[model samples]
Target: MDSVQFPLSTGTYSINGRKYRRTAYQMKVATDDVAQKFEQFEDTPDVYDDEPSAGCLAPPGLPALKKKIAKAKEVKEAKPESNSTEPTEDERISVIGGKKWIASISVPACFIGKLHGMNRRALNALENDTQCRVKTPRRDENKPCEISSIVSLECVQRCLDRIEIFVDDAKKTARVTHFVALPCDQHEVQENFEVFKQLVLDSEHFDASCKNPQLFTKSARLHLTLSVVCLFDDVDLQRITEAFKVIEGEIKEILNNKPMIADIQGIDMMNDDPSQVSVIYAKVSGEKIQEVANHLNRRLIELGFAKNEGGDEVKLHMTLMNARYVAQAEKLKKFTFDAKKILEDLKESYFGTFQLTEICLCPLNSNSSSEKFYDKLAIMRLA
Candidate 1:
């Protein structure tokens, strides 16, 4: 069967007299090899009543197809260089063990610098152990969720298992490892976040009377987590990188030479259910964002390099805070914070647009205090 893939732009698109909405740029893959193989059947639309779930393994011949494409690409590269000035902009995708590696991109520099500055402020705030909690917004006041969670046993187990690993080390610096994400700079919208944080430090927490709050998220460490691999090591990175190289063409195709100018505005709350610490994050929108996340995550799972984080789609957001440190603190391991109250005030407020440059394969929370949050193992840029 033949499959066609393409980028779905953000907008309301009409088909079969029906209108559908999509937010970010997303990858769409459909297979009708029987029809695509024959020119006479090309015009016919092949509808899938139930498409294969994201967790399913790739159909046979995928590896051979990858090798064929790589061979063809190699032949094309053999023709070699037009060293013209414009040609310099094209940097070949990095290869490891003779394979392309999976990588992530970066946000604009000015935005990242602002995030670092905010991180410094966040770090300074740590000096004062202020306790807080989330006040639930009246159900009517909040908007619908931008990102959805898949409630599969696999997902639940994966997240909980990872949490368990870190739960033991809450006192020391956490190396809560292995997650896929997109970087974004939100300082422009969060200019007064430091003050807002102060309010959180002094505010009353819902459901808890404790004066101590959970540890705050470092602004510099902000990212829209795509998938959590749960447990990963150097060997895992090696396996993941080669697996990514095999599908490099498809990844590029999904990107469709599109530049990453994303609208990462708004604040929102994400949580599993009614609990104490609601995850507060700046909202991210678009199909490209979701598709890229699904593509990378699904591919890795298929290769046995990683596992699914419940569902395929990623709800994009740069997480601002959670009580991650609460249970791990040596002295204040369990401080409560009213993340819901803070989110209620900023939830609909616009942040701004961000221009994404490259994608780097970052080791999750593996950086030292002196290092940048992204310890890139491999890097790639869009044309």
Candidate 2:
């Protein structure tokens, strides 16, 4: 027997070594019959339902296909319900003062400084950018800032959002309570600092001009402040300590297991005027010292313990004299010293060099011991 051929493009099929083609009318009739049979099957809910028959086998994708169809039907049924209930953006906005909208946000008194810079310039900028009216609180007022707009609540919300970001940044950069420092109490540094203190105290010009001699910094309390932070309580202290502990290893690695040799020399007043000075400090300088100080300060900010304060470079100075020190001397009124003679005399004086063995976390309000250094709450060794 000859091999049978399959259906051809000409619409003819071969079977049992014979070929036959149906007319167009016959083809149409056959198609109609097949479609009608499928319609009947669909109408019989039991046979053509989403679930497969218990005795029939199911394909691997049959369950997934059924779930998809069920989900699509649910979505179609829910569309009208959602359309009927949901409000448009404009309707969702709460109306206040008829056409105008308003929002009040409470702010802390400490953050009032942050709002001060929102002056006429900043207000104009905000109005132009948001096309809204923002009434900033007064410097002394602890009240909330008011925002309003005739356009939309979203515009007022935008102004509020900008103010919040500005205040948040101010908080991060302004608050501080404790400080990190390297004590300047090594034997050689202390000896030199004492000599400089004595020179200022002994000068008749300095002595007569400054009646209060107790304004000098105690030798034991000499230190180079590295960074400052605002810690609220013991819990905050513990949190900061843990943060410090983690960064301690990085600081040590930065030092490369070597003690920092700090060069303390020369005398300079904190204020620009040399004649009327409230603070006198010995200049501290060195490459490694600055590198370590900057790294520690940057890490403190990254860890959120300290403020950024505009820069990472630590102003390394060992304060030798401050007028505030006179507060301990018999409830005296705060005084400034005439450092004109002192400046002329010791302008080129060298304090001395010493090895910084450790970095310490110290309280700002605590009294210094006989050793002259503030109480160290925590210490990280450099060598």
Candidate achieving the largest lDDT: 2
CA lDDT, candidate 2, residue 52: 50
Q: Write the per-residue lDDT of candidate 1 for residues 72-118, one digit (tens) a residue.
A: 99998997644322211113112223221211222222222232246
Clashes of 2: 6
Tens-digit lDDT track of model 2 for 1-383: 99998543435558899985432321122356336322231111222245554445677689899999999999988774322222224542345545676666655556554454455666677778998877767766646777667897778778778887876676566557688998888788778877887777776766464555587777888889889887644656787788778778888888787777888888889888776788988888875888889889898888777887758588888888888877656576767778888877788778777788888999888775655578888887787
Model 1 stretches astray by more than 4 angstroms: 1-176, 186-214, 230-233, 272-275, 331-336
| Candidate 2 lDDT (Cα, 0 to 1) | 0.73
**What are the lDDT scores of the predictions, listed in order?**
0.51, 0.73
RMSD values, in order shown: 36.0, 19.5
